[model samples]
Target: MENLFFNHGKDKLLWETEDKILLAISGGVDSMVLLRLMEKLALKETIFLVVAHVNHKLRQESDEEEAYLRAYCKRKGIPFYSIQWQQATSFGMEEAARNFRYNFFQEVMEQTACNKLMTAHHGDDQAETLIMKLARGGSLNSHIGIQVRQPFSNGELIRPLLQFSKEDIRKWAAEQSLVFFEDQTNEDTHVQRNRIRKWVVPELKKENARLLAHAQQFSQQLEWAEALISEQMEKEFQTHVKKQAESWQIEGDWLMALPENQQYFFLSYFFKKSLSELQVGAKEEQLLQLLRLLKKEKAQWQVAFSNEWFFKKSYQQFSLEKNKQVTDEHHVLHYDEGVYLNDREWIGILKNVELDKVPAELEQIGWSTFRQDFPKDLAKEFFLRRRRDGERLHLTKNLTKKVSRYFIDNKVMNAKRATAWVLTDSKNNIYGLLPFTLSYLSIMEETDKIHYVLLYKYRE
Candidate 1:
């Protein structure tokens, strides 16, 4: 035990002599052995140790386990903390417990000013994880299973006992006359992981006695492959993905031009960003379908995920945005200066300025300069709304043109047209396009009495 601690714990600088460490103890043999080892280390090094245990209250012995561990820590003169699960749910109990445990560990570590968090995931856990990954057809990233060390929330998570087998930990605990509590639910074959740990791993060990070692070797190989692939994917992401103000934009054509594996990684990179636990294997088809859509010209589509995340492909540029609560509905409001159109995502204000003073930049798409004519009845009946189909606007005194044809001729993408808003009156006389243009009634000469109605468009 000392050799292992010195070689891996001390030599690797997993924790400094003066550093405070937090251990996640569950009153199991593995965690108990880890606690004992940490105690031995603390005797030689001036380090602080804090123990945290979570009581899920699922078993009758949960309270007993917590009491025993707390008493042990009390006798050892170490600080111990325990939290009970308040909310209970029958479905997804394993996942829920894991999330609750980790969140508690994070909170405790923060409160104690601990620099490192220690866990007791040993060789058996790694073997079971690998087996599950293989069964689920996991990607190269999943092949790494549980790492010895990783970055936790604002600190480091160190699994020092990963190199030790479950049997080895139990044997060491017995040799040292250490006491620990066992949760009998571990023997419940109803749980998939318990079944795998008891039967699948033991059966595999028959073929190779050192199955854990072989699995570690395979993981190392996968790690090497992933390192190379990850470097290339990062470069591709930097080159193609761009961060917009309220969304992320990716160059669709450039992304699709890469190799299929690189493309998968490129999409997976963003997927893992928003959906951290998303399994790429299950959603690969959806990604492929999106890629296919991107290849088509004028393709405008969106896929909504949890937490309001949406992937929108507009022509050759793809954007990932969080969908706002505001829907794309036609909103009609009485004409009032400085009115904000929440549904249209724009602010309407009538600014009084010289007609010739309008910036030439305002002529660009998504910005417009309109001159408002104050007819006594027009001002009273005027309203703001989203553009409607078959609406016509007069380009000349005698010539009227359909607004839809105007959009088509102007080469506006269908995606943008769908959510486009316009300003008009109750009599259906269009005064201005929300973000595109000003009608002839509004576009004036230098001497025209300019209400100078303008819309400042903003992303929702």
Candidate 2:
């Protein structure tokens, strides 16, 4: 057991004499055995070891466990850091405790300048995790179970005991006569992991005595397969996906053109990359629904990806972004002044101005400036607002066209059609479509009276 632990640190982890490791000890047998193994390694290599413990304060024995571990660390002349989780939630106690524990470990690592944080997750834990994930169902990546090493905080989280089983650690602890705290809560069958550990694992071991070894092998194999898939997925992602400030954009046509399985893989990869911290990925039902949405005749649609995020398809582009409420706001604007239509768009009117006399700022290449003459007698107070459904623009005294039909006929993108402002008078007369087109009535020349030159600008 000592040899396996030592070689994993030396060969797999590439541990050097100067390397500092922060060990997350839970006062359980598994972590106690890991602490002993690390102690032995340190004696021979002069490596620095720091012990970090989280007193979850969930059970009556929590204080006793913390005291026991702290005394042991002091006796061993090792640095120890501990924190109490005082803000435990009533619900999701397990997940909350785990998060709190790791956060404390990260803090300890930073304080000690440690480059590696070691945990005591063993093969049995790995098997249980694999079974739980398989039963719950998630992306293929989740099936890989607990990794041997993964990036955490500023360094790496190394699980050296993954190659060892629970029995192996218990056996070593007995031989060494190591003292550790036993949390009686682990025996509660109501807990899913405890249930699996007590019943399912033994049953699996009955079928194959080397169940832990098999589970570890399966995890390694899945990791290798996922690594290969990720390599290709990255290449495809780089080629097709675009990262905007607050969202990720993908070419809908390119995604739909791929084989169905590839499409699923691509989306899974995309979600994993975008929400890596959340550990949320696209499930089969969600992916199938998204595929159906993508293939539909509608040019634009959106669905909730999760509580905090959404999947939006606009024309040929698909985007993943946070949930945002689309507001139908009206802005009353004055001449020579601009109002922000949106975060990235500004709209204003320039009255009585010729094309050649347009302000230099408005003459920038990207500004979508338009010029049109509105009747001098029209209401001075013009409002900018989103196009109303079935709204029409009077082109002339006898010709009027539906604004929606005009947008369709002009091949206006769904995004622009949704956000474009309709310039209307106080009487709800549509005179112009902001930067796109002006109604024919707006272009009609009044020979005997003056007209207002309405200039619109839309910056990116």
Tell me each candidate's TM-score.
0.74, 0.84
lDDT by residue for model 2 over 275-352, one digit each (tens)?
Answer: 775565566788778877766788778877678777887677788876655578888877555566655565555445
Best by lDDT: 2
Itemize residue pairs with steric clashes in candidate 1: none
Q: 16 in model 1: Cα distance from truth in Å? A: 2.7
Runs with alpha carbons beyond 4 Å of true place in candidate 1: 86-88, 134-144, 218-239, 274-285, 295-298, 306-308, 322-384, 390-410, 419-460
lDDT of 2 at 57: 88
Best by TM-score: 2
lDDT of 1 by residue, 1-460 (tens): 6478657887678888788999999998988888989898898889999999999998898999999999999999999999999777989988999999999999999999998999998888989988888887745676677877789976899988777788888888899988888888899999888999999999998998899887776766777777787787777667777775556778877875777666677787666554554422226566777667655675467876656667887666677766655364555444344444553354444445433343344445764333344322244545665566688877776787888988877766655676566667666778666567657765556555535445454443
Separate clash counts for every candidate? 0, 0
Report how far residue 44 has shifted in candidate 1, in Å: 3.4
lDDT at residue 381 of model 1 (Cα atoms) = 44
